[model samples]
Target: MGQIYDLAIIGGGVNGCGIARDAVGRGNSVFLCEMNDLASGTSSWSTKLIHGGLRYLEYYDFKLVRHALLEREVLWQIAPHIIRPLRFVLPHHAGLRPAWLLRLGLFLYDYIGGRKLLPPTRTLDLTRDETGKPLAPGRFKRGFEYSDCSVDDARLVVLTARDAADRGADIRTRTRATEIRQADGMWQVTVQDTATGDRSTISARTLVNAGGPWVENVLAVGAGVNAKAKVRLVQGSHIVVPKLYNHDRAYIFQNADGRIVFAIPYQDDFTLIGTTDIDYDGDPADVKISTDEINYLCKSVSEYLARPVLAEDVVWTYSGVRPLYDDGANEAKAATRDYVFELDLPGGLPLLSIYGGKITTYRRLAEEALQKLAPYLKGTKAKEGWTADAALPGGDFDVSAVDALIAELLRDYPFLTPAHANRLAHAYGTRAAKMLGTAKSPADLGQAFGATLTEREVRYLMANEWAVRAEDIVWRRSKLGLRLSKDEIAVLDQWLQANRAQPANPMREAGARS
Candidate 1:
């Protein structure tokens, strides 16, 4: 066996990354491999809301809703820059879910999570409150206001990976584990780097499969066996358009079929509406937003909005398949978003697999997975769980202090514009100082890579963050690609050609072993 690892995790989604962060913090040497850019899968395709799942109350999923609602605050305190409180408006309808049921659900939502910093849910007068200004007369009479949190899903995954690496875990993005086998009481794994087509091998005491929608695929194709082949795949899609209205509050409108739709303020200039449930059977990577889904979502929004949401209004759209633990639910909409863990000690080498988890409960899911697989470690010792209070990378400061922190940063470097300072604060939080360094003026920053990206940030991403491809910088590390010109992207491509790392003649990396 090669150098022993306490855990080797496949798939760099939120669940895998969170487990890496948690396991490494517990003194377990870890190796995490991802086939594509980190969080490039379903982990990044969520509606980007971290709520207590108020709608889940209808199905008696009170436990999940309460946990999610509670995590809304916990994660906000840890990563205030990327996560913040947002108000949602539930317009009272003449027919759908009676006011009494909605009221009781709100009451339980507030009390179930042990209500804290967030404001309590309250009755709204659609005609009086500023939140109801853009409504059509006679359409909206009353509503309710409740609190939830929005997140940059990609960054959350990256921060988890960053924290795990800082804790001494080795992260291998753009690398795919081709095969795993148990030999002589140890697990042998072969990995191929997708970029350069380089292959190598490694060995670990335990293997973890957290491949999100590809969980079953990994077990069948990579592990070469159908282990726990009792999972279901359900597709959910979202669409983006120019911000529909100027209100800061979101609207949740129930459709004719008892399903709900959300119209949210996105990127300060766009509105994000989504999520239609459809049964999926194809490869997850190949899933795309269908025209029917687009029409369905738009019609749902049209039912409540003063302005109808037409297909032309959609600027961007995406789709993701949720790997649900099949509970034999007939309807995709009624399926559970909760997770399950399957631990098998084949050849005395433990393999822990994960399935069906939402963003809100990833941390707790990681803790539980660790405990479930703890006994498999045998005589080898590992740290106990303690990630609850720990601050993730750049999340040490509370949200209340963000303004003060930004003010101090700007005071030190007056040359930086407010946009630059805010962007840095948003990406790096207090740790923006490390990226800013001693640059006194804009010229001190390296080449302009478009959007708000500076050369300095590029170098920082290459050195600290596991940024490899140009797409990694444009899409994941930063959303600058959405705002940059074509010429600017060309410049980034040129810069990447010059800075590509030279691998050894052996044609293998240190972490590649079978």
Candidate 2:
């Protein structure tokens, strides 16, 4: 027998990382293994909104909405740099749901979670409001504005993993928990390091199957359980294109089919539009954004925009599946985003399975997961909901007070352009200091990789976060790939080849949290 843990997490997406952080903070030994990079799965391919999902309100999921909205403020407070409040403009159109219903929805949304930080909704005369300048004038008249939050979903997952590590949790990326079996009322889990092809066994009293799209498959195949819950995997895809508008405001469009889509401002020069929901089967790892999805998304957005968008306009695309709790909704869009916890527990050892979850609801999801496992663990009060006050890594600044901090950071780093400084602050929050390291000048920051990406930033990623591949730095850590060229990407790949560290030895047990 090697090291024993209180928790062994099967996935390294946001939910897994969030749970690991929660368990570690509760003074439990934890080991987490992700087969690929963190957020390499569905967690990164999100529409990237941290909101109550306004549409869910139509379904009358008041409980889910309240929890998600409350978590939104909590997350924004913890990582103000990464998660920030956003305003959405819904343009009133003819032949759609009545304005009275829309007003009622927005009114309830404001009051859903005891609104505090976010401004309340307002009616907008689209013809006069600045939010309607780009719209085709006669096609729209009135509109509504509401609050939500946007996030760098991948970085959020990584930061939670980082905090868990800082608190003494053992995290392994590019490692797969290949198999799990029960013996003596404890779990004997085998994990394989993909890079080295070495395997090691870990023991845990609890095994959390937090796999997102692969949750059911993991329960049935990997964890060797014949029984499982009702879950449906629905694939959702997002497409990024050149910025269509020049405002901080995002547009929430209602489709002809009564489905809604978002056209949100992204990465300074791009707008992120998405999410076509379709049933998916087969391996979650091999899921891809298809041409049909491209057409559907383009057509849907084109119907509402002044200048119609086409497939050729897309610069980047991402797709992933949502593990929705099977609520018997035949329509893919109608499936629930709320999560359900199922236990494959045997002999009092716990195997908790998580179904669907929105980015806004991860913290409460962790709390509930622990509550379900409370009886088995025998320490019900060890770590009871402390995330509200704690900041993740560099996110200690006031969420509303970020403008002043960004202004100060800009003054301190005169070499950084105003826009670049804001980008760094948003990506790393207060941790931008760590990314800068001791580089006193632009030259000292190492070779400029591309866009604002520098060698120093790369080194910082490798040293602190598990940034092993070029995509890890580009696509997830920062959206610099949207700005970098093929040549710049090649250089980072070459640099990683020469400098990337080997996966930590499975034989060598972790000594500290980080």
Candidate 3:
């Protein structure tokens, strides 16, 4: 007898949140539930690029490449604070594909996507260009530079969910959809609160299973629906090390194995090198970087860099299992990155399940999802193509104005250091002032949890951002975990536990599971 929503999405990854935002913007009643925190799955563990998948051209996936290539500027324009253009340096390897092929790929990449805002590709002289300063001498003589955009992947998901909430969509974190059944032409879903062990049932006209790697399990176990489509769980791992180069440009090194590896500037002090693709059959939640993956990453990047990266140089490592649609590709790296939707409308009730998508195409996927469900959703005044022009929360300003915003914040809060102010502007954009709240001194902001993470910011995250655990604030919300000591993290965790009931704003609860 609970409220019957127009759509009940069972996941909090980027795709689910994106769909919720688009659906709610169109004036549909939406309810989204996540068993864990937002972006805690493969969403956060991306290579963090809004790119056209230049490597995918070998497989002749021209449609997928063109679609993602076009989204690069679109995402950058909307979320300028978190998404910005990043030039990638592709060093020519003599043993790999010919330079002409690389040039052709870049040429296709430049023109296929209707690229306008980003600069076109150009050949680089490794002997003279600054981009080659950190490369091994005589190993790489020529390179190609192309455009893509880097993203704060976790923040993208959080902001999308926040925008949905602002538009009247209910977003519940730490709530798992335990069961789903069709009853009287509607879906009866049973969801459980992971924290409090409370259970509730809600009804919805349509259901969405955006469970990422758990998409198949959700269909078989949660909904009791047999899925005709299968998901191939491929594990990709990455490693973070001390800064490999002083410049901001990232590197794309082609390996002899026909796969590519990226060495991207990360967190101001580290370089992110990654991604080994291997078939994964274990539980997705338990995926972790293996010794072989680390060794492979180190060796792969060491081949091109001036200094060799060893296991001792690794600062951190993380892994995620990608739920790619099984196309029977012999190699895991060859699996299609395009999204597939399986809509089952048995007895006239809709259950849509998603599989195999990359971060760059999540917006397009969401738009397509809504279009598919539009037939089942009656009487809802929903529209399409609204998200293309809509800016995410706190991202209303132009991308070029971030520096000016930082300067304004400095003038207002003279007590903030330059680094702290810059960090805040990048993370929260215009909403940084909300966390500052007339504070004039460091003490006014509250207890420092290392690396400019103040109690004020923590409380702001809890109240406005649906953050509860220390890891949520330290790892996902921000990468302050790399700087905070274990003792500092423990203190913050203890304080959070002690102040659970005393949120900064009591009225704005962190998505109560009604």
Candidate 4:
């Protein structure tokens, strides 16, 4: 028998990566496999907020709201580079919930989660506040401003996985778990390399199915486990348009259908408006934004914005199927955002399948998962809760130190343009220095692949992060896809293909598994 790992996790989303990071810190041997690149699934397609579900308050899900709300600061502290406070402007609609009720909801939101660091909610005068300047004349008079956080959702997942890999967890991307079976009191997991068509088998004492939308399918097809728990697939879609507002604050508009849409300042050039909850019945991987969903988002935002956003204004659109735990909710919007775990330890071998969770509370979910699996794995020194205060990779500095870091980079790398320097500092934090090395000019950074993307940065992503394809770098690792032309992208693709056969560094090769 080969070396049996303490845990084998099957997913590369936030939950899986979070669990791997937590479990590995506890001194447990962990092996994680993803069918595609990290954060390529629902993880990358989030509304990109580390927030308490404000709308969930209507359903009286105070526990979930509080839990998620508490995580906002915790996550911000740990990954300050990628997670930052975002004040949301909730404009009151006379046709919908009353202002007093909104005030009461904001009150509960402020105090329920041991609020600290973030500012308290306050009433806003739309006519006077700069936040309302983008709104139509006399359309909204009063609003409520509350605090949440914006996150680089994809970077969060990748950084978590990087942390786990750094701590000796075997992290494999583009590897699919094909079959799982119990053999002699251990889990025999068969994984296939999607790129090479190579197969390998590994044994583990425990298994975790953290496949977001594919959680049910992982249990039924991958592990052949008959699960009693059901997952409701809800499709949420978003569209990106030219910047709708000049201010930094995000807007949350209340719609007639009892749903709310958010218009957030995205990447300095665009505003991200999203999310319609509709029942999804197809493959999660094939999910795409529909015309109706796009129209709904445009119409939703048009109600408040000074200028209407037409379909022609949209630059990009994405959709993801949320695998919510089916709670018999009448509508997709009503589905619980809380996570549920179903542990099946048939014949003394454990298989923990996870269902339904939002990104904000992923760390808590991971801690809970380890606690449940602790009883089954004896003699394993798994630490209880340490992730709350731990900084993710390249995020060891204070949130206020980002500007200092940027200034230092600008001084050190004089050849870098201000925009390029700022982008690097924000994307990689202190690690940007390592990528820059002793380069005195842009030419030293190798060929430029449009925008500020250089060969040096591309090589860093491939060598350290599990970035194998052009889409992986352009789309998930960075949103440079929005800026790069098709021709530039084709050049990037060609470069990646040409460099595919090269051997990776020792550090990266150590964590990667076939």
Candidate 5:
């Protein structure tokens, strides 16, 4: 007889990691496995906004909107390092949504969410405001600005997993849950390490299938539940291009097709514009931004911007399949973003499956999920809403103090550029110092892998954050991929593979030896 976990989760996305953190915090032993890397799926492919889905108001989903809106501040407070307030400038289109209607939606958006720190909505005079300069001349007269938050979506998941691991939860990446069964009053899960081809079986008192887009496949194939899938796969895509405007504000443009598009400032040197809502029926892993999607997004933004966005200007494009709960909506765009749970207890063993949740509401979803499973988890702590206040790893400082943190980094490391210090401050927060670790010069940080990424930082990611490959380092850990050449990336990949077996603290050891 082996130790049976209180919870076993089969997903490394936001929901699964979040639940793992909350469950373990509540005194339940937890184990979580991801098929590839953390946030490697739909979680990282979001529009990267923590918003209330204001358009959902038209669909009469006030509850979902309100829940998401309320969560915006809570998420910002806990992970201020990766999340910050962003102002969206919505230009009034005479041919599309009327100004009065937009005002009404903005009003509901401002009041329903218990907004405290975020600025209130204000009217923008496009004729005079700098935000209007990007739009075609004399085409629009009025606009409105409202508050939302932009996030480093991938970092959020990784940090959550890191926190869960710190709290005694067993977190494993590159692991797959192949088969699930019940025996001896415990749910048994057979997991395989994708890297080594080794298999092992573990027992848990309860199981969770937070597989996102693959939730159905896990239930029908892996768990053999013989139930119809309730997930609706919707493909949303985004394209990144050179920075469109000089200002910090983002734009939300209304199209003739009743869809909304956003052009947000991305990575300091580029602008991110995206997101189409079309139903998809293919493997979630195969989802990609199609030619049609790219053309459509470019045209959608071009309708408003003075400088037309063409396909040739796009530097990168990515897509993800949102596993929305199949609420029987006629159009994919109308599908609900609210989460739904299906709990099955066969032979007194519990298995819970989750469907359709957005990043903004993941914490609330986790809290509610634990509440539903409370009866099954004995002696769990009564910290129902602890996550709302607890800061994630490296995010313990005040949100307003980001500039101060950046200044401190530059003062401590005079060898660092302002841009490099800013990136480090946001990505690692107060813990940036831990990676720098008494370095006096750029050489002390080791080889520069381009774009301010150094050997010391890469080793820190591998040692603490489960970064295994170059893609994990350049793409997920940070977006240095945009700056690093292909040859540079390959060099990094080779270096990581060759040094895979080295000690996690090799840099510190080398420094001490000197």
Candidate 6:
């Protein structure tokens, strides 16, 4: 017998981490386990936008649209470092959706979800606008510019988990929940550390299955719940290419097939164009960008841009499986982005299984999950919607002050390049100084990996952010993978392996023991 937690979350995606943060903030003891690194799955593979799904409006998903639309500013305010408002250029195609319908959609998009800080929708003359320069000449005359926010999606997950850990929730990465069973009115979850081959059992009054694409697998295989899956695994793929245009704005182009693709600015040097929606039946872990998906993305964006994007132009491609709630839509693109929950109180224990949700709606989904489990979470303060006002770690400053913060970092760290200062300001917010730790020169930061990554930053990620492998630091913790050469990455990986004895954060240390 062991200490029974108030909540046990099985997943480390955005939804799971968000729920853990919310639950722990309400004074409930929580334990969260992820089979791999946080956000290594679908969460990191998003189009990187915090937006009201404008396309969902055509499917009459007004509720989801409004809910997501409202979260835009909320997320931006809380995490201005990793999340900020990004204007998008929507060039109207004469052969596709009508202009009147586009206007109606944009109107709904602006008003719905209690939009406050973001600018309202306005028409654009693409012929004169600089945004049109990248498009084919004389083809797109008029367009619309609207407000949405781009996010470092992986950072969002990591920070949420970090906040939860700071607030006393146990977050275990590289830990798998192998089996779940009900005993003595408690749900006992048997977990294993994937890295060390160690096992333990944790008991909880309530359990959450936030497995994303593996939601059904968790229930059927881990808990032996035999119910049919309520999820539809839809694969979405994206490709990264060299910067398409010099402008900062993103583009949302509509195709003849009624599917829309986004070409968003990424990492200051690449255009992230994606994502194609197709039915996926393979293992979620094995999902990868197919040749057709690559060709489709290239053709779709090429249809609007002056310079055609060929497969040769693709620098990288990634794909993820979205576990959409099975709504029986004819096409994957038409599936509902809204989430659904299945609560099973078998023998007086609460087990909540989540299916299908977008990044923008994860907070709301977490709040609702708490509401459903409120009865079981006794003696907990259960403060409702406190997360709305609470800022994640290092995100305490005002949203409008990002540039000021960057300048402040440059002033404090005179040796840092302007680009380095900007990256630190955006990645760590006010905590950048803490990571730098009074270092007066590059030597104080220890060995410098390519792409401005340093041994000091690497240690900070491992100790504070649960970053273990080189991929965790380069790909998930930061997009330095794009810049670090293979040799540099190998060296970093070797260094990490050699330095595994560095002190981990208190929560991580505790997680290892548990």
Ten contiguous residues minimizing lDDT sum, candidate 2? 505-514
- For candidate 5, write residues 1-514 as lDDT tens digits: 7878999999999999999999999889999999999999999999999999989999999999999999999899888889989999999999888899999999999999999999999999999999999999999999999999999999999999989998899999999998888888888888899999999989999889999999987786456475454899999999999999999999998889888999999999999998899999899999989999999999999989898999999998889999999999999988899999988876777778999999999999999999889889874778575799999988989989999999999999999999999999999898887778888999998888888999999988887788899999888889899889999999999989988887366335435211
| Candidate 1 Cα misplacement greater than 4 A, ranges | 222-225, 378-384, 502-514
Which ten residues in a row are the worst by lDDT in model 1? Answer: 505-514
lDDT string for model 1 (193-287, tens) is 99889998887888899998888777865564557646788899999988889878998888988788898998777899988988999989999
How many clashes in candidate 2? 2
lDDT string, candidate 2, 1-514, tens digits: 7777888999999999999888888777888989899999988989998998888899889899888888888899899999978999998777888899999999999997877888889999988888888787578899999999999899999999989998889999999877888886788888899999999999988889988887766676557675557778899899999999888999999988888889999988999998888998888778899999898889987887788999999999988988889889979888888988888756557889888888788888888888787676643347477777889988989887678767877777778888878888888787776566555579977778878888777877776788999999999998889998999899999988987764331112212223
Candidate 2: the clashing residue pairs are 165-513, 168-513
Candidate 6 per-residue C-alpha lDDT over 1-45 given as tens digits, one digit per residue, 9 for 90 to 100 = 878899999999999999999999999999999999999999999
lDDT of 3 at 67: 99
lDDT measured at residue 49 in model 6 versus the true structure, 0 to 100: 93
RMSD of 4: 2.3
Query: How well does candidate 5 match the true structure in TM-score terms?
Result: 0.97
- Candidate lDDT (C-alpha), each: 0.83, 0.84, 0.91, 0.90, 0.91, 0.91
Clashing pairs in 5: none
Model 4, 1-514: lDDT tens digits are 8888999999999999999999998888999999999999989999999999899999999999999998999999999889889999999888899999999999999999988899999999999999888889897899999999999999999999999998999999999988888888888889999999999999999999999899977876556578999999999999999898789999999999999999999999999999899999989989988999999999999988889999999999999889999999999989999999999877778899999999999999999999999986653584578999899987989988988988999999999888898888878887778767767888988889999999888888888898989999999999999999999999999999999777244233323321
Look at candidate 3 and give me any clashing residue pairs. Answer: none
Model 5: CA > 4 A from native = 222-224, 506-514
Instruction: Write down the RMSD of all candidates, one decimal each.
Output: 4.2, 3.2, 2.3, 2.3, 2.2, 2.6
The CA-based lDDT of model 1 is what?
Answer: 0.83
TM-score, prediction 6: 0.97
